[model samples]
Target: MALSDIACRNAHKSDKAKDGKAFKLFDDKGLFLLVKPTESGWGKWWRFKYRFDGKEKQLSLGTYPEVSLGQAREKRDEARKLVAAMIDPGENRKAVKEARADSFANSFEVIAREWGSKKVQTWDEKNNRSKRMLERNIFPWLGAKPIADILPKDILASLRRIEERGTIETAHRTLQICGQVFRYAVATGRVDRDITQDLKGALPPAKGEHFAAITEPKEAAELLRAIDSYQGSLPALCALKLAPLVFVRPGELRAMQWQDVNLETAEWRYLVTKTNVQHIVPLSRQALAILLELQPLTGHGRYVFPSERTPSGIRCMSENTLNAALKRLGYGKDKMTVHGFRAMARTILDEVLGVRPDFIEHQLAHAVRDPNGRAYNRTAHLPERHKMMQQWADYLDALKQGAQVIQFPRQA
Candidate 1:
């Protein structure tokens, strides 16, 4: 017989402590109200018992009073249809739980960390810089939001806030990193599209002033002399001197490892962190001499310019080490920057030394296209670059000795 709503509500606790049992009332279609004894009174729960795929299972429709008799029978009838179709309602419940778990694992913070772990493999600033960029600029706004649900406007709004702080370059870089995160999410099937694409032309134009470089031969000669006179730590002084000769990025120069430099072969080979490519820097004789002189001091350690503040000397010098040294030498930010070394080398190598532009660009590790519009190999133009690098070093030495060098005429 089917149960009535009145009977479920009137069900009272029975003191069956001696038997250690409770009473159960049955309804049709395997629906029943379990009257279990509680400390205060009787507790009634609705349960449906059925068989699916030759095995019996039970589905809890919820408690009684909360889930009345009519509601419990409706659930039982719906579950019965699932059983008739060879499905288990219990399995459906488990599947729902698994889907929810998967969604949680795909949250923005979770996936961003996953992508960061892989990216930090090639990073040189020790991953702290990139991590901080995300934490400060990207995370607070969108970290908890679902990656798929983050539209272009949300990303644009986040970038606009960064731009308002006067760090326009940082704002651009933050947007780029966000795009990488979105692309990673897309590849992993977390999001359907990289909405950052819609944000083209969304940012203010960046200021076009190149890093302040001493492109004039006389001015560069003076700068080189000043670096030679810098009374700083041996590591700091050596890095300052080598910056102009190698013309690599400041971070790459500071993080140089002794293992990457082969003084005997006059070659320094290391992976370029910015481009994710292996670059070979042919050591000019002048540059090699500085490395040889400094090797005994830092060769025992991992870095060519190890941190002086550290007794262990295991870590590389900080990014600001060279800039601080320049400031100490009376060169302000407007006068010269650490990265200005690359521009200085590029200008003099072309205008003063008459080196081929392609050779110079390849040596500087700039992404350049061949006549066929293909990326020049990292090691492409080795023979020509090797010659150009030597000429550049010799020209600098001549200029340092007060030799008057004539600037080459630009070809039309």
Candidate 2:
């Protein structure tokens, strides 16, 4: 006979002293409430006794009142059904527990970090930049969410927050990386699909403002004169002078090492940090003079532009060093940025000098392809680039001397 709820609530514990002994109140379908003796707090537990594969087993339904008698009966019937199908309910519960553990182990952050660790090897400084962006933007909001459970709205909300800070480009890039992570998750079977696909055209278009550059010959000449007269630190003076000649990114300039320079060949070769391509910067007579002048000060250390105040000199110049120098020289960020040097050279070299676009692109380390769809290797137009670099340096000198502007015919 099944036990009644009235009988369960009024049940009494046995006074007999026994170790781990309990009095059983049997219910239907092998369900029973075990009332422990008074020494054991008279606790009650629901148990289901069954057989599977000709073997007897007992499954604990749960404690009484917490799991009501009605609930215990439901669980007993379900386990009996499993036993009829020759399955062990205890093993099934263990499998479900393991599955849940696997899901949490493959959570979004865990998978993203695993993917990031593999990706950062190819990315140089971008590794740190990506880590910072994730920690600041993505991780706080969605890092703990299960990858399989994250909806498109969750991703869009995070990206929209980034855009709120006026870094739309960063938002776009973060979305791109998120898509990569999602695709990786899909490939690994952690998630069913990459919902980032659903977010196409979701963000506002990136509003890109070109770096402030002085394209006009006369204005560039004035800027050059101002830079030449800058009486800042020797590293700053050298970086400013070399900025126009090399036109590398500011970070690249700050991280320049001494070993990559070859004064005899008049060339400075280093991996372009942005593109991860080996780039060769032809050192003009003017550029070489500036490097040689600073060689005495920073040559002993690892960096060609080592920080003066740093004791170990392990770190190079600060990223803001040139921009700060420009500020002091009255070239506001709106008037000129350290990055504007690349634009300055790109505009002047093509508009003023008769250098071919291909030669200029090669020197700039930009990835370009011919009509044959073959990507031009970094060393593709080395000889022509060398000549073009020298002509560009001479043109800057002519401009600084207040020479008359000469316009080149546009290439067809």
Best by TM-score: 1
Q: What are the per-residue Cα lDDT tens digits for candidate 2 across 1-412? A: 7788877776662343255466788898788888876553678889998877788788999988899988998998899888778789999988999988887788778888878787653233332566667778988988888898899999999998998898999998888889879998988889888899999899998886568877788899999999999999898899999999988888788888889899999888898867778988888999999998999888988988766668577777766778889999898899999999988899888877756888778877888899999989877878777777788889999999999997887544
TM-score of each: 0.72, 0.68
Model 1 lDDT per residue over 13-34, tens place: 3343335467778898888888
lDDT of 1 at 125: 40
Worst 10 residues of 1 by lDDT: 120-129
- Candidate 1: residue 138 Cα off by (Å): 1.0
Which residue pairs collide, candidate 1?
A: none
